[model samples]
Target: MDEVSKNNVIDFDKEINLLRSRECFNETGFLLLRGIITQEKIKKLRSRLEIIFDGSSRLSASIFDFVAEDNFLSLVSNEKINRVLKQLLGKSLRIYPNLTARKATFSPWHVDDAFSGNKVVNNESNSQFIQVSMFLQDNHYKYGGGIDVIPKSHLEETWQIQEQSLSESLEIFRRVRNKSVNIDSVAGDVVIWDGRLLHRSSPKLTEGGVDKYSLMWTVSSIQSNHKEFLTHLENRGKLKESIENRLYDARYQELTHIKRSDFSNFFLEKIKKLDINLTLKDSS
Candidate 1:
């Protein structure tokens, strides 16, 4: 695709509005919210990040939720995303704890079957989840990097080539690359794609290049199967924490602070109003 159609990308506050932005996500499997976050908030986050990080990339991103920092939470819960999410998902939204912060990193081609027990995730026909990512700096082909995705790829059955042979994966990639396109965005933009969509970081990984700071998190519609969803979490936790050979540990261990007891009255009440499920103990 040369450029995403107007229907797939919308201004954060443009008055000439569509009746519902949710339709875009359903049809295209992704939506770009232009300038969803202001520069002020992005600047604040960068400053705080400078203090907390030592110029190294890490996968344990649960620190973003620390009540002490409160920097990332402010962005995650902003009204722009909440409104879009509420409209796409129902009034209630359940955000998974699988958030990640990456710096100048590139990922291989794959689909996100996050929290699912096994790799045979073939249920994208009615997907109710999305991966939300926002970059701290501009993402482009010239100066920096961004995501490239196969639009509507969710409609096709996926083959987790990482589990299969390289020859088979190469054959599949030859075809998959025919449909992929680079997605460019600025610091304040938010990019959301369906959980089943085939996507990857663009321009490949380099030795030394512009830093691509991105924060990614997942969200689910409350109407999804809760029991199965909980099981997915259980499997994800055990598989990673137990699996010796792993690139990054599962996020469950880093989410202990989400227990209702850990949240103060102020944030607890706020979280309650957002209908964010504090699933640590199922109480709160």
Candidate 2:
């Protein structure tokens, strides 16, 4: 690997061992890795992502589903991440779709594995699933964005301890919360967590809006009946296409589904407007 790649990929054995021994990751069920990417890489990735987001129409849910793109593939194919996956899951790690590229926001408390059964953590002999969230900017106090996770909530024993209503108001959930930590992270930090951990986006507590750009990747062991999980993700992608059709002009579809038609003009127009907005904001 190149020097840049080597620097970006942390030593899996050392970090993982430290995390486990300290119970920093095991107890909290999440690990926040700072400086996973250098500033140069973040700037380049952000620029490429802005192009994708603008041309494809940010409103189109499928705008995030660009796994085949070089930028997205580069993240998944990172040597360090692959090694970690091999150690934690197995030899084969399958990347799931709908890789998120957007401003992070508040969310209701829930477990990702609540929908699809957790394959990695529960399986004894096979690979498992883990999520890596790459925050592109600082999300801390007053910014009103970050993750709030219930400690050790990934354990089955912890699940049994709660009969809490998932429908309760955000404040109620906050008040009654136990040992939940707000994961305020900085740009280039990567947060790795088990899929079963109970997490929610920290509520927007202030009126001052700040963009919390982030990238998310979900990976599972190939032996973990991942075909079923992939199918679910594929269906979600289709759902995004359907939603886009209903809400947007048909011309915009060509920007992403390039084979459908030529959308150069539309793409150019969208990106130009995006450039104008950025320039104006910077000037201001």
Q: For every model in order, what is the number of clashing pairs? A: 0, 1
Candidate 1: segments with Cα more than 4 A from true spot = 16-20, 55-57, 64-67, 115-125, 142-144, 161-171, 204-209, 244-246, 250-252, 256-258, 263-266, 281-284
Give the C-alpha lDDT of model 1: 0.64
Candidate 2 local lDDT, 1-284, one digit each (tens)? 00111222343334544324224444445666654567888887767666656645443224324434556545655555555555555565555433556554455676664232443246222225677877776666676445666656666332321223555535545644766667766666676777767777766677776455667767765555555555544444455467734334222233223321222344324323322111110121
For each candidate, the alpha-carbon lDDT, in order, equals 0.64, 0.52
* Model 1 poorest 10 in a row by lDDT: 113-122
Candidate 2, clashing residue pairs? Answer: 120-128
lDDT of 2 at 97: 38
Runs with alpha carbons beyond 4 Å of true place in candidate 2: 1-27, 55-65, 113-127, 157-166, 169-176, 235-284
Per-residue lDDT of 61-117 in model 1, one digit per residue for the tens?
A: 443344444466555666677777777777887765455565555665677554233
What's the CA error at residue 220 for candidate 2, in Å? Answer: 1.2
